[model samples]
Target: MYIGLLSYSLAAIFFLVLLGVLLTDRRQDKPSRKYLLLATSISILWAGMAAFQSGKIELLFIYQTLEVLRNLFWQQFLLLVLGRSICAEDQSPIIYRAKILLYIISALMVVLIIDRHLLQFIPVLAHYIDPLLVGYLVQAVAVLVLLEQMLRNTRKDMVWAVKFFCLGLGGIYAYDFYLYSEAMLFQHVDNMLWQSRGLINALMVPVIGVAISRHPEWSSGIFLSRRVVFHTTTLLGGGIYLLVIGFGGYYVRNFGGGWGVIAQTLFMFGAIIILALILFSETLRAKLRVLINKHFFHYKYDYRDEWLRFIYVLSSFDETIPLPTRSIQAIAQIIESPGGMLWMKRDNNIYLPVARWHMAAVYDSENADTDFIKFMEEHDWVINLDEFEWNPGVYRSRGFFSLPDWLRSMQNAWLVMPLILQDKMLGFVVLTHAKNRRHNFNWEDTDLLKIACRQAASYLAQHEAAQALSEVRRFDDFNRLSTYMVHDLKNMIAQLSLIVSNAAKHKNNPLFVDDVVSTVENSVTKMNRLLSNLKDDVRGSEDKEDIDICCLIRREVDNRKRAGNTPNIELICVDEKIISTANHDRLASVISHIIQNAQDATPVSGNITIKLHKHINHAIIEIEDTGCGMDESFISTRLFRPFETTKGKSGMGIGVFEAREFLQRLGGDIEVESEMGKGTLFRLHLPLSRVK
Candidate 1:
């Protein structure tokens, strides 16, 4: 049997089988199913006639009649499937009239094909008109109607379900239209098209089979998976490969002398081996899948699964695992990267490799002054290294140099995602080449990466803040302990001063000497007590009492006068006792600290004056010294800061701080007014004791 005949015979058998199934299956007796059944039956008959009666004039008329009837049935089937009203009364007037006109044209063609003698009545019509050509034209119109219906009514979501149906039926009539139109124009059919027509029709049956299987009624039992498309594509590719091999073999066999047959056979076998190798390559398959999914699929990712997996990785929170490592792994897994390194920002415009997952070859640190860092910081770009290497112009346009040698030296670096927070470049992470290297990064990849970077940067920023806060807390605790120790030392110094004052008078007599020794021993014991209190973590306690503020000021002035070398110290106060509610020891320590500071600052000739007076409900004490005073900047910025002082090695700088804190505790405050190289005034405000 001829190849064309055999192909048509096989197609007829398939369609007949399909028709029988549709008829016998009582469930598929709906109007749409019946219309489809009728169209398929017509197609089967047409194929059979074309296969067996290619040259018979009588059968040619039958073939043409079947073509017109097939066109009409298929057109009606499409109209019904698209939910268009087939009944003339139910349709709009214009649609009804158009359908009637189409029916009239089909009927006239059928009549012309049936009665050849009718053509003799009009010589001009006979000369120009051919029944075979008229059949193709009518079929072409029917194909156009189906196309219009498909395009107009098919929704995007339903395209996959009805895709095969459109391709199958559309392919059959479209090819017929082309074949017959060419035949009419050239006066005969093209041999190649005529021979392959049966094969083309047979191929469409499988596609139509897919459409029927996907139909709502039949979809449950016969379902198409992604594997079906993959296998179909593979089969089509294999067919093309074989066709190429056949052409190559024919060329070699005809051109070569005696070795032609042998050469052709060897060439075909080698080609087959090469084609098999190419088809089975995993890398090529991955690349092809990526290309198809990127361009063909509506969604790039299965967001539900991707989101769940991403959250799982981020929330893992294993203590043994560093956060940066976990962060890099979480982002890298999204793109299926093999490994990556995380660089965190360090001081001095540097980024250091803080954590890595499976990538050991990256440098320990990189300077942020590099062009790459500058570009990423300015644009907040997620750099694709492969694209950078290939298209340096993209980066160059943005004022970037080629990929740095340091980065290129790291063999697997594929992407650099910047960790930016609040317009600051925290650092960046460099992902190694993905397991599927052929998949290029798109906007989806960049968007996901940037979001992940933000999350990671937040984690890093929080961790750094927590560390700084902890250090500040430690310093606060240390300062508190030191303040208590310093207050204890001041008490010890006061005890020593009393002993020193009586030493001269008591030195000559035994009894007085004994009393002097006892006082010295008491002072030593008190000094030991202060040291012991410091060791035991004793905090300063407030013991508030109604104390004579004038008496306290007089006693401090007298003590300073006795200890002074030449600086004149004078006290001016009213005789009426001015009492204040205060912690006696703490208030005394504060007043003493201020007086000592003034005396130390004053020259031998400078006079220090202590004046006390009552103002409303408070007692005001002014200690004025003709001393070298402080500038405004020093007084404003550092005067009360602990351990900040101009006394170099001699002063601890905590005196003003301690004094200010103590005075505030006693419901009082201190104010200073001073100028460089002139005089300093210290004013103390203390709440008066209500007992009066």
Candidate 2:
């Protein structure tokens, strides 16, 4: 295959692609682009004609004509650009000169072509080395002249828009000058140079495309995809980088003849050097990302990315960073703030620094009624301190005056962001200045920061809520512990009351004296254990020790017997040994409580039956009382209620509630059944321990 044909084919394809861009580009009503489109079309035709003109002497004229038209169209396009640029508003006579230049070019086309074809017999024209080739020489000089004037006359500030264009188009015309000058001097075209021209022109297409992009007047601002800009930029930069690295490695491996090891070492070190700079110098990368976001996008930040990152930072499993500090960090990253302090309102109604991220500890706090606090609550806007310092009148004046000494005195105070939760100002974060970026603060930044702060506010709120709940649980545990203590005391007092009431009657009974000693010892042991539990101050620790269920019931029955013989006690247990894992003191107190209630409910003549047996891995204790019975409604609804009791003033009504709860904690539960004018039965189910 012919090399020129292949090169021209590729050039034609490149020009066609450019033509598509022009056709599809949303032009901002620039009539100049239409000339560009025409010029591009002429390039395609010019290259295509050259590609097909293989040794065809007749088609040579058409190809040469196409070249002239392509040049003329390109020059015409430049005239239109000048009309909009340097020569715009009657600054120059480029339009009129372009008409005169076109006439001169038309005269050359006629004189050159006709002389070579029809009037070659004339010695004067023949002696002058190829009139057609001279015409081509003149066209290249004219293009160079126009390019020079365009570059020189363009305003200094507007030079960038024309520079790339001039370089691209000038390279083409300059190559033409070189090619035609050599042909005229030697009287024949250089075949190799002519073959390479198509490839050279194709390379300049990208440069021209970039030039068009630089001049925004070439297209309208219909839409610009940020993702396209970012990815395209990344790909271009990466391509350039890989090309450089590939060339460097080629040089290292091939050119280092005797120093192979040394060359390899140097190459490795070069990579390390680049890695070191990338690892240590973050300012460049940060600035680059910021620059791309600030310039290319319609918005300052990618909200979706920011939101995901914010949530991840807040909910990360890394516990070394507490919730409050993570809250500060999440907000700080949005604005590229280096450090921050989170001020949260404490229980004392004072705003204090709950956490600080990359900042010094803060000891200052503000009363809730302070003007700053009130201002933050009323007006929920992200306060830019620098903006406030510049224009104090725009902000609420009261808040500015009430700012603390530490805050006002700080050197790099940047912004104060309010963490607003459901319309309430939960807290505010103080963000410091971004490290080396002189970023222009705008409403977009504020809006994004506000949303992020609100999200962070919820996280901090949940954290605070969890803390409050935990504190409440601690107090609740203490209150329940106190209630259990009081209930235990009530049982102990009943035992003492029984002893006091029976001391006179049993004073002469030796066996009764031993029973009195045993009762006192049991009460003393319970008091000591209560003291130990109070000292420990820990609650909610279930299952302290294994209890012999059989012995426990019998003792509880005997203790209730000593309380008063109001109701005669009966014990029935088939099992000799039934072990249960439970708190010894609590289980005993609960059993005693149930028995005391049964005794109080029964008449002096009525009997209380305590029946215990193992049924399906559970030690079921049935306490039935033959006395004034309860209705089914009371047993169902109010029997085990925390504070409902028949003996209103004398009873602490949490006994049954506590009893049922304690039983459930030990893999056991209580069931109550009763009817009006009938006896009530209390059935307790305790899961029998695996141990004998």
Candidate 3:
């Protein structure tokens, strides 16, 4: 009895100190602070009564009544705190429903008040049920639900202020629920646990004091965090699940004939596995998150979480789907929408379906409806299909022209957000109904959606830009390859020009005429190959064949003689036949370019020499000329550079560069020795084919 007295006395004193502090504050009286003052006053009275009536059976009614009143007052305080946290201009529907529930709890209190009188008149009512005990149990449950919602709905930033308050209130109501529930089953309360209640309430006094200190006026606002609601929901669901499972086990044990123990054990394991599955299901978690966000939050979205989710979805590295499809997903996920489709404006002024995610295909094209585009550009509003259907004036221009029949026919179509960037609508995304069908999207939801859709527009813009850049790079490569074909054609034309000029003189010489025929045949074959290459890209592959360098160089020298006999040409050969593995046409072209260049450089009185010899494993062909020789600077720097020549407009400049590049491809190289006003030596190193 002394311990109970000490516990309640301590609780009363603790609450008295908290109340005095709250009253001392000079801050203007607010709705939340008034509720706190009332709750604190009731707590002191309840504790004082319990302390005084610790050993008296006659005063038990007063202490129990005080307990019930104390619970009711605190529940009201918590509910009001929940209300004051809403910063929205309009009242949340949740607050209205909670008030209705509070009225129901008040009715329970009224019944408890008159239950004793009714029992006195009937006397047999006590046999079936105890109204006082059941009333306390049900009221405790209602208070617990309020506390849970208080924690879940309060903004995360404001959680610190309300956390201790919810905890303290939770402890008081939880103790009452347990006491009353046990009393209901046993038809009597345990004296020991009843005595312990005062100590538990006293312990919560300091916790409540801490909460009051954190918020002197309860000025913090409410916006639900998904994390808090998800965890709270899981805890509440798990408790109910265990209770149901316990009842089922009890029923099976009473009913089973010989298999009670075995059936009960198997059932428990199966229930545990099923619980695990439910806890891990992503779909269930998504639904739970959406439900909590829809009902508990004052605002439609938690901006920080939504922004982070947007970034994560847009920038995800899962590249199996294209960016357009991911753009649809990024927008769809913002509202917990099931699926959506994205349309982009093409150059032909048509809105083409670029991507779809889990949504059925829709209208193929839009006729570029001028009013539709103008309305989206002007307002930039997210049109809610349901609201537009119910009242067309909500979107301002729904009467101008009805939505396309294809869009109207979509049974699940819910929202249409124009993917507007820089005041120009790039396209629009149509979202299917969200996971939470009861979602009454408001100004804030549309505001966030407009921003998200604009961001998605910018992302798709970059995608389009990237695709265009890639196409340009391909065109640039083709243009570069076309330049090479033109250079080859110029060289062939120069060869044929030399033949025409010398044909009048060489027509009388049998050997000279035969050399002309051979040269013309080579040119025609090369011209055919070049034309085939232009028709179908060869990608630089050519067949290599063994060619005799002595004969090849002789033929080139003989061809050069057809240009003019004035620049006397001499052939110096150490080996009659020297074979090297190379493409015949390419090697022949290389030889012709070198000798022709030598002939062009030497004057009529000047001499040109073609020398062939075997050195080590290579066949060396040297073309030496005496005319206007190049200095070391030009030969080293600009000589082999393509399209660079002293010949001006007449020179293609790619001949020497192309020759050296082709020779290198066959495991050979070209070396030059030249001096200004003297002569130039062009040495070709051709690797000899292996001796059989």
lDDT of each: 0.75, 0.76, 0.78
By lDDT, highest first, what's the ranking?
Answer: 3, 2, 1
lDDT of 2 at 303: 72
Off by over 4 Å in 2: 1-6, 25-30, 54-58, 84-94, 110-115, 118-128, 151-160, 182-187, 214-217, 221-692
Superposition error at 355 for model 2 (Å): 24
Q: Each model's RMSD to truth, in Å?
A: 22.2, 22.2, 21.9
Query: What does candidate 2 score in Cα RMSD to the true structure?
Result: 22.2
Give lDDT tens digits, candidate 3, residues 1-692: 98889888988998887777777765636777777788789889989999999889888777777777777777778778767666554766777787677667666666666456666765677786787788788789988998887788788887867888888878888998999999999999888888888888887876676566666474233222558657967987988998899889878877876998888888888898899999998657766877755444445467899999998889787746667778889888877898998878866566766678898756356755666666776788677888777767555534344677677888789998899989888999999998574366655677788999999999988878876786467557757978987887799888888989988988798997888888889988987876544432223337877778788888877776785555899999989889998878778877887777887788988998888898998889888999789964476446766556777756656678778888877778788878789999999989999866
Q: Give candidate 3 regions above 4 Å deviation.
A: 1-297, 300-302, 367-369, 396-400, 409-411, 438-444, 507-692
TM-score of each: 0.43, 0.39, 0.37
Model 2 C-alpha lDDT per residue in residues 636-680, reported as the tens digit of each score: 335665556787656646678778877877777787766666678
Worst 10 residues of 1 by lDDT: 531-540
Q: What are the per-residue Cα lDDT tens digits for candidate 1 across 1-692?
A: 38667877877887886676566656665788878888889989988987887656567778768878888878777766655423445555755565676688788887888777888888786687675576667667677676666655667756665777788878887888888888888878787787688888887876776767656543324333445656666778889989988998999999977999999999999999998998997657656665644433334566678878877887687866656778888889889998898787755567866677888644345788887788888899999888887767667878987766678788778999999999888989898888574365666687778888887788778876876686577569767866876776687677667667766866577887777677678767866765543332223457678889888877877776787544888888954689998777777777877888888899988988888988998889899999999975466446766656788866657678777777776677777878889989999988888893
Best by lDDT: 3
